[model samples]
Target: MSKEIKEKELIIIGGGPAGLTAAIYATRAKLNMLLLEDQILGGQVRNSYTIENYPGFKKVSGSELADLMQQQAEELGAEIDEFDMVERVDFSGDVKIVETNNYIYKTDTVIISTGATPRKLPIPNEEKFSGKGIHYCAVCDGAMYDGKIIGVVGGGNSALEEALFLTKFASKVYMIRRYDYFKGEKATIEEVMNHPKIEVLFNKDLVNVEGNNFMEKAIIKDSIDGTEEEMPMDAVFGFIGTEPKTDHFKGQIDLTDGKYIKTDESMRTNVKGVFAAGDVREKEFRQITTAVADGTIAALQAEKVIVERKKNQK
Candidate 1:
């Protein structure tokens, strides 16, 4: 006999703020559902130093906010399976098939909230110094550089914000950018430019990193003058935006040119019972508030679909 299949009315394939919000709504609707996460309950949010734009609170640490969201979802009776990675998905049949490393789940509705991951530089030695000197999350690794010099790469909002946060631990923060200008909000840009600890390097790029075993210095080049310099740095943090995590749903789902999932206003995808939400979906904004809104819509639409199906069966 084939392996026994576990069935549910809905399966949410993420554990970020979007997925946790969906779980809260799904439990309130009394829908039989499960939320599967690849590793920890928190997603990229855990890497954030502080969240100020999420409302309710003026400021809160990213880890604290994530813990609160997870606790709320669990208290609502949401069945969450952390550390179960989704290897494949088949949405061809009426019942969506989701195969994880731990189990195979058959569901009438599927919500995709995988979110996005940080983008890395194009240096050959970047991967080699990943854990040694190069890092993606400033909050997770900033303390290691206390009273030391560090470098940050990127020109976007995230890069500028992280550079400012790194100042809490690092004595000096070198803001390296490929262009002379920054593309973040005016307020944030002003703050970064005015910060005493942050040194903005215009029209410059980080070519490579060097050290004995761990990284000790950064090779920076001037794009305009074609000059290079090796700057002593204790660590390097990269925050050059993100890439959508939609490789698994490539053929089965519709995606934008950037590989982000395409969803309607209600968070419903092209497939009948498949939905996409949060930063994984093609949207102009990818803030925590927007992710929560997307999750709410997806969860309500999923409940409606399941209810209509039961009515039709009767």
Candidate 2:
């Protein structure tokens, strides 16, 4: 931590579509803004192999979309600091304090777009073989499983897409789902079902991961029956769901079920000068377009409040 404190009109956390969009809007508003990301820019968007639903382009890769958004924000004069981990935050006072690994930021308003992270299984030995074999990101670790067999857990769009993506490297891919039917787009579900290398194991749940240094097999149980089977695999991937990255903001603002920040249509949380957008907030839809829309609304609303305060002060 640095003793030097930096001041800005607004501070945006996370570098996903939501955070980058907020930065773009704040820059156009001519307010001094700074964006901080704990790791590589784009957040979870980087894990997506391809994004077909986002507007404008009929089809685009996740990395490509993230790059375009990041480039646009930078060209519009948004200052961004990547790989800056936010250690803690204080939003109780009017002037919010955002403390990262390197610096402490004091700002009139804060936009929290930290987004969400992939959910992992609570099975046995999951911690021991986390990076060794059990992986969460297919794009990040799929190449290592070339010609090897792997299992994917979840039934959502992410799980479906990852199952197909892993087919490029893994000789055999098992898509294990707790439900009989998948909960992804119809087209994608059909694609995964029809893929030759991908096998769908419905009504199945992962019970444990077994291995010495690296994962070698998995214990899967039939959700309907009590029958369990051992399936040999080199690696396993999970895309079941996501948990909000709001640990730092906890107790500082209002949160809903599952610790998601609660905000109105304006994206304003319980805190007066603090707002949350994207997947971090409680909402039904957590798509890229929705996240961007949330970011836009939050930025505009925050700007309105700040401008009003300055005018009143004058």
- lDDT by residue (1-314, candidate 2, tens digit) is 34679999999998899999999999999999999997888878887888989889898999999999999999999999988889999998888999888888999999999999888888878889999889999999999999999999999888899989999999999999988998889999999999999989989999998988899999999999879999998999988789999889878998887989999999999899888999999999999999999999999998987898799889
What TM-score quantifies how close candidate 2 is to the native fold? 0.97
**Alpha carbon lDDT at 284, candidate 2:** 94
Candidate 2 lDDT: 0.91
lDDT of 2 at 77: 92
Residue pairs whose backbone atoms clash in candidate 1: none
Runs of candidate 2 exceeding 4 Å displacement: none
Candidate 2 contains a number of clashing pairs equal to 0
Compared with the true structure, all predictions reach lDDT values of 0.92, 0.91
lDDT of 1 at 165: 93
Highest TM-score: give the candidate number: 2
- Taking the tens digit of each residue's C-alpha lDDT, what string does model 1 give over 213-292? 99999999999999999999988898877899999999998999999999889999999999998999998888888998
